[model samples]
Target: MSILLIDSYDSFTYNLRHLVENATGAHVLTIHNDSYDLPREKESLNKLVGSVDAIVIGPGPGNPDSAQDVGIIPYLFETFPKTPILGICLGFQCLCLAHGCTLGYLEHPVHGQISRITPIDRNSLFRDFDTDFDSVRYHSIYISTVTDDIIPLAYSEDQCLMAAKHAQNLHFGVQYHPESVCSEMGSKLVSNFWALVEKRETVPIRDSHLLQTEPLIKHFKTTLEYDYKYEKIPKVDILSACERFPDPLLLNSALSPGEWSIIGLPEPGRSLVVGNSREAGLTVGTWKGETKAHSDSLWSYICNHMSQRYYEPTIGDPELAKCPFVGGFIGFLSYEESIPLTVNKITSGPTPSTRLCFVERFIVSNDKHTFVVSIRPRDKEWIQQTKSQLQTCSEPRFLSSVKAKVEKPDKKSYEKSFYDCQKYLHAGDSYELCLTRQTKVHVPKTVAPWELYKCMVKNNPSPYSCYLDFGDARLLSTSPERFLSWNNQLSQMRPIKGTVKKHPQLTYARACELLKIPKEIGENLMIVDLIRHDLYQMLKEVEVTKLMSVEEYQTVYQLVSVIEGRLQDSIYTGIDLLRHSLPPGSMTGAPKKRSVEILCHLEDRIPRGLYSGVCGYWSVNNHADWSVIIRSLFNYEDDLCSTGTTRCFRCGAGGAITVLSTCEGEWDELNLKLDSVLGIFS
Candidate 1:
């Protein structure tokens, strides 16, 4: 049997797809009804209905009547009257209305509420259903009148017609979501519906969504569950120890360019790095399972999941006043979802483009001269072994064998892409599109990433810098642009949008003059507005702490903006804040959503992987920060490598192309932005 699930886009649509597929083992195809008709000539109405044996309309907000013109549901019922049909929530109201019933607004709408369901008729559909069961109902509209052709099968506590089976055909409508995990009887209800479908072909019964690595909220009221202490280790010692073992994962950050650092080292084969929230503790290359392609929803789940976990905590000595979540999620997401703002996903780049991570042992720095080692109560041995490793640091390791052989994009190709971005800007599809390109580097295995990281910091350092080895790949990021930062203590975001590369010949006045170009200012304003909207999702009143301000970096000066909002609610965690602001605005362009869609289409729909994503840490104190994945070295193993030692490394850069953007100008900006990374190779 096949089931065609028409997605009306509820927050749980992804969950719905999984439930229906796992429950029936049916071939299920879900399409966003709103865009199903895109490219109408190719996806004609007939082509969509050719393979399905049944149509299941999933739940979504909004009235069914309002969606009549966007979907083929009404026509499908008219053409395939006998095909098994099921309507869930909005879907139910939709099919019900098509069958000639009138709908009414609920006196009081219930969203995410558990309500009693009393089956009024012992229809075969309710064979195993309890006389009164619980189900989740979230709706503002209800079936006010059931025409003679429709028989009400169930009612809510308020006597609302919650479920009805069409008397004339195999059509069934249920206003309550049987698939919600919150409802105890949801699964049985769904199963029963499936059973009915089988008996009639069939008989049936029915219904129904982070990274929960550690507890999201800090336990300040509860006694400190862990203890801490610090050590004054020589830099040579820590560096020497890390060199001895190249097999373990390393996440290191510096207090300054080359001195003082906090490094988190996880035992080999025991811990991992994650990019997608769905896969926790699984390193980059080992992830074979599917992830939520829906970027927005995926982020929400990741934040909620990570915040709620009670991961063992690592206590710091004297505790750095900033207690970041000792061990939690880290990594980047590919902005490849076919969101409304972007074109559909049509690219198949096999790179594990999304990576997130969880850390266990942390070696932190309180002062540049002093450091602390934090781990769970039982991880004393691991901590000691780490310290012991750092103890052997007098000699330097020979890591660089060959320089990165960089391959730049064809000038014309990039110019063409820049023009492509402008086309969208002119079309109003996006106000400021971050169009990026990368240089492919054929790297030697002996050219160690850690060594390159050292060079990057020495040559060009930033406020947010990180170096991580994810087994399959290593990331050395030194980004001045902070995508988002949250202090369970406070909520704010620092986004970098404008740019002006610095040079010996350029005076401070001249640099500031170039940064003040009208186009740069306009681009910054467009992104600031979009970012303010993002912050507004969590905060009722977001404030622009800084605007059109210039922040100088080692290689360039950026037009930076600071926006903050109150996180008065303690229920939110760093994860929650990130979800509302992933694939940072500066990278996505103004009108973030549509711009992503536009870029996807222009980039051949290939996943940006870590190129435009984020790299950062959730602090032990419940604060977190991530750098935009720009001006970073991204490397990974390749099967195409004829030599085992051959690897692929990339340094990426892009600029926001506004209507005022010229191909030559965007191309030059990209080159200047990436000079920090590509220059290190020279």
Candidate 2:
């Protein structure tokens, strides 16, 4: 059987796809609603309906009454009256609106929250389920009135219309999300819907664009996780060993430029990955590392490279095999670059959109041991020199303090944007929009970038802290949020959304109290659902292991959630997952595409550079880990700026804006986030 899922640019559409596939084992195809104009041509509409036995309208943000928000959905209702159709949250409201039903605002909107619901009748969609159950709802408007032809199937505890079916047409609608991880009996609901679908003889159409065969996995026959002999790349030559872990800040600063990265700090760093470019190593783009010739988009090139070098790691030294980074590409994808090149046309920038280094020689340190090894035999000399440098490395001192020229987003301008955001929110344009601004700081030549990095970590230690020197640009990040991480079996994403600035008087209990409110919880929940959607797109099973929990950081207390999904080796690889889930949802906000579109105009259409991007490594062991580039400082040599005595540094900060947000509160949050890094200068 085949099903056509019409996506309205929502994050949860794939979760629905996963649910439907698991329920009926049907071949599901998805297309955006905007793919067709209103009144789809007679020939095109016939072809679209003939290809599938059933059609599904997925949920998304924005009002159903707006044509711009729901493209061709109303037309589909009229064009295919006989086709089996199912409508979800936004889709449910659209179905009611098409049948002369009106929507009413909820007294209190619920997003990423669960509510009790009961079936009025033994409807096919709720057959054999519990009498009363919890379903996840993410809507601000409910169907207030039902037409005489509409049969009510279920209702919420508050008497809100939850489910209905058209008496005249073979159509059904549900206000609650059956695909949500928190929803109960969701699979049964989807299976019941499929059972009611009228079975008809239809030609199996080949959707080459939407349905492709899963990629084949190349298995390696080796006992060790990394088979240097099997690949014939080189042998691991350990030149040095540090009995006691050295300060990453000092050790990283001593390395000479090529392309270098330090993934953790001495204070609170975990799963440390430290490496620099070597003449024998391989490099891509303009950054340091070994040299390689390539002409392609950055993401595709990395994806292709990782695919060829993919390996299976099993039955080795447990500690060594489990290392997150076992020598691979280390770099970032800028916010502007994360947008597909076809969509993002404005390319003016001082640095490349992506910069990565293939480190053959690097350091991998756990709590018990730190090993400096090289995969390339040619890097023996450089590895030895690196060992000598770290042994003799001394703490660097700053000659002068960094100074801020000015904050680009002054309070008046920020307030204007804040009100504008409210306008969009009140109109149901966006449930949550992450707004960001950049601050420029000036530093003298005498003060090295490494010294600044040291100061930043000393003041505010973060788990994903890193220092990157790409010759043209330098980035120092102390971000607490793990954008995404995956090993051989599973992938995880930890997104931090709510923050409470630390003060002497505030205790951990007090901070938790402040963050457990409606606004803070809503902010975190939106991102959690959005990320679940992203993971469910490719992963086989996704679960929210942690939801809306408070964690204390150096400068602030943040609310974080952990989402994990099992990896299907034959289908998508870690690189494929990275390519699909770019520009982390936490940074972009919920209803990601729409929120980003709105953010561009609000932030003056300027490239965010490296501020809201991702920084981490794609390891050779088929393991990867990345962190959102928040609480970061980036300095580059632009042609417009002077290079003699002082250089310009840029830092970006922002907060999520919702209907409950105030201009002053958002501004204070923005500053509080900025101060986490900006305080380093003082």
* Candidate 2 C-alpha error for residue 538, in Å: 1.5
Clashing pairs in 2: 259-288, 281-290, 282-290, 283-290
For residues 25-95, could you state the per-residue lDDT of candidate 1 as single tens digits? 67566666664443453335445555566778777544567644226566666777777778888778877
In terms of lDDT, the best-performing candidate is 2
User: 152, model 2: CA deviation in Å?
Assistant: 3.1
Off by over 4 Å in 1: 1-229, 232-261, 272-305, 308-319, 323-325, 334-350, 378-385, 388-402, 639-643
Candidate 2's TM-score: 0.85
- Per-residue accuracy of model 2 over 37-111 as CA lDDT, tens digit each: 545454665576787889889998799999888987888887788888999998888899999998888766666
Model 1 C-alpha lDDT versus the unseen true structure: 0.62
Worst 10 residues of 2 by lDDT: 229-238
How do the predictions measure up, each by TM-score?
Answer: 0.61, 0.85
